[model samples]
Target: MECSDARMLLVVLMIVVAGSRQASCNVVQFIFGDSLSDVGNNMYLTRSLARPSLPWYGIDFGNGLPNGRFSNGRTVADIIGDKIGLPRPLAFLDPSLNEDIILESGVNYASGGGGILNETGGLFLQRFSLYKQIELFRGTQELIRNKIGAEATDKFFQQSFYIVALGSNDFINNYLLPVYRDSWKYSDDGFNEYLMMTLEQQLKLLHGLGARRLIVFGLGPMGCIPLQRVLTSSGDCQEKTNNLAINFNKAAEKLLQDLSGNLPNTSFRFGDAYDMVNDVISNPDKYGFDNSDSPCCTIGRIRPSLTCIPVSRLCKDRSKYVFWDEYHPSDRANELIADEIIRKLGLSQLNTTNSFSQSTAPSPAPFS
Candidate 1:
């Protein structure tokens, strides 16, 4: 062979290898939500009322200590990430969160008091709203671009998965509080429209930022939570509050369907946490639990404050309780919910034993 021909072929082979290297994308999870998925971002906020730092918070987590999760152990996000064999994304506000960590496993921007709307958790004094979390993510994107260049960064987000579980606070904290103007400003359906409108915009922004594979978790039966139940004179689930949740969930389901159809190269799925948890709470015996109306770690005397403080009452067996606190699911309950979410993400039939394969991710076709 001629010397010029040999040199030209060698150069072409090197270019091909470089191009492939830049295009490679490893699947990871970018989580966003409130307390249900909070891995302790609120801890950094000095005055955040919703920080879960008590001893009972993480008794079931690894090493039996607080790892920033609001529940007794892992949150739904943690369980799903583990089931998929993905690394746990560090809390966005964590001191250890850096460029290397962002590249290794994305970030969890979930704050305990966070919500879909910026004004949702205003009474909390400090929390990252959905918009704020997205803003932080944009900063992370810049850092990633500086480290790996824009092309590779774009591919990274395109291939990665996103889990956004929020909006409950918009009702439970803001509108229901009566302290916020949202309560008096809008009626039930009006509030629903307001939330859906804000959420649609946030989701579109995320897609524009390169997110393609994503799931938005619907609210659970918020009224059935111990906090709301304790508020009632009858100690029963507030059916009115539950109805509000149902309506919002329906709107979210339709919004996702439309977004999926309209948005190009996007697979938007709705994780029906409302129906899933309602089934468990309605029939605790089916899930090896005796009581679904109470929280295991709360000061369970049926008061408004259902927090699991250091001096609060404790249940005999945490496993038998579905709720870890007034507002969050127990570790075991989270496990069940995570499995449900996995199924919703088009992973029900696949062999999860192999760890989820991003390459095979499917669109959010209506579940059978």
Candidate 2:
């Protein structure tokens, strides 16, 4: 071939290779929510009680050093990052990390004790609510635009994955507080509806801010957590709390369905965490867990009032316990949940156009 022809062929090959590499690059993930998906944002807060930067919290995590993750190791966000072939995004509040690098990769805006409503975690006095988290995300968006220009930043978000795992704290920290008497004011169904409506508005706000691919995790089986179990006389699951979570999940599913129909070019997946964790609690043996009702770390009576302090008794084998502390799941259980999430919404599956439609039903199989 002539030298000019050979040069043209080489240019074509380079363009094809570059395009392929861009297509194969892992999708950037921006996480938002409460403690379930919180990496370490609570650690940055001064007066937050919902912190995990202490001994035994990250015992299973490498180096046995707590980086503010509530579990005995990684959270679902960390596991999902690994599964999706991306490094776990740095917490947006971590001062040690470079802001530019974090924005380029992704950022975790989740905070422990956070909730959908601004007043939800007010009892804690220092939690970043979902509304505030989104406000922070808006700052990140500005930084992204500064770094890559507005057009490129818009495109970046279009190709990114957004995971939101919140609302559980609304019940755990706010409505259920004896001092609040939220139930008396709003009844059970009324409260759940209120939460769903607020969540729908926040999700729509996120979509407006450039998120296209989104995964909204439903409230888990809060009644079966160690904290709730301790509240019961027999230490059994609180059926009322469980029912509330189920109702919320059902409403959340419908919300996603509605959002998909209303929003243009948006793909929403509702992660049924209530069903996922409930299965593990119901059949611990099936998931290689020895204890599902009690937490691995406890002090007084395995209750919400007694958190995993520095002197708290730690479990010998953390993997066998479904919960690490009173409120959070063990790292093993997190792994299971994350794996299930990936299986249901893998990168290959996410690439399809069918995911954009409301007609596409989520996978119904429970986590193994």
Candidate 3:
């Protein structure tokens, strides 16, 4: 299908589903993941070099002040929150923040450079691992229970969406790092299996913690990012990395299937970010982008070596570029990705025949 047609269909699907739902049920969002979904959590960390609270980081974001997002503007979490009629959740670590209102609205526990595995982004000692994020959520749970009691808190979680966008850092910063010896321990498939298993365990923990509506975002085309492009002699996509991502996406699909079947009264949706992003990279013009291989802000070969600093030359039009820096997607790209996610969620909701009835359990459609 044409990209525009697909996007339109998705919008229609979302409208249908939203209209069918109870108007009184306020949708809250609890987000977790790495830089892609992080809304300034890293800035609160003293040891993180992944901080984006500097000039040029939020140049495209109105007001031209960095809000700690690693992109030129809003991340996927912010856009998705807006789509679901929720304000962007405040970062869990941000001090001087209003904890009561923010926690009730929901909290973004994503930390830039974080991953599923505790050791994934070890270079950044301060990054909150998925485990740590979950622990923090436990605290939030306690607060919710204290305010509204356990029964209301359980219903609150059941009505909320738990969004997780992770795994890229595991491959990019851990397995693929020169210093890491993960290569010696397992083949690509083996490593992916281990990662998926760990992810499943985390999801189970979330399930136990009262999450009923889960949205797990798959990894994107990591090989096509500027960092990987500059590492290649021909500046082409790193096919090995791409294959690994594809394999992991497939594994994630199965994991979601298993989780849905085993975790009663729960809904699971997998967002195929790999396919969505690969399409943009393959046909940048179709997405109104002029550059996909090069970053909008960079220095020295446009790779992660020099990194995007204040002194680096910034692109005049960030919307023309797919990537804002060596790794993260620009706000434009993130908007597209977020649209795809909303579409996927809508599709899942539409396919499930009796989504609102507690007595009926609808089998979710498989990941596309």
Who wins the TM-score comparison? 1
lDDT per residue, candidate 2, 124-217, as tens digits?
A: 7788899999999899888777765787678777888888999888888878887766746888889998998899999999999999989888
Write model 3 residue lDDT over 30-72, tens digit each, in one string.
8999988887899889778788877777766656678788887
Model 2 whole-model lDDT (C-alpha atoms): 0.78
Q: What is the Cα-based TM-score of model 3?
A: 0.85
lDDT of 3 at 344: 69
* lDDT (Cα, tens digit) per residue for candidate 1, span 1-368: 99999999999999998766555444767998998889989878999888888877777765566778888778887777776767678999899888877876789999988899999888788999999999998998998899779888988888888989998899999989988999999999999999999999999999999889888888888889998888888988999899999999899999999999999998899888678789899999998988899887766464556357767776878788898788888888888888887886655321223333342221211112
TM-score of model 2 vs. true structure: 0.86
The deviation in Å at residue 84 for candidate 3 is: 2.2
Worst 10 residues of 1 by lDDT: 359-368
- Reference-based lDDT, residue 304, model 2: 60
| lDDT comparison, 1 vs 3, better candidate | 1
- lDDT ranking from best to worst? 1, 3, 2
lDDT of each structure? 0.83, 0.78, 0.80
* TM-score of every candidate relative to the true structure: 0.88, 0.86, 0.85
Tell me which of candidates 2 and 3 scores higher on lDDT: 3
Specify the poorest-scoring 10-residue window by lDDT in model 2.
359-368
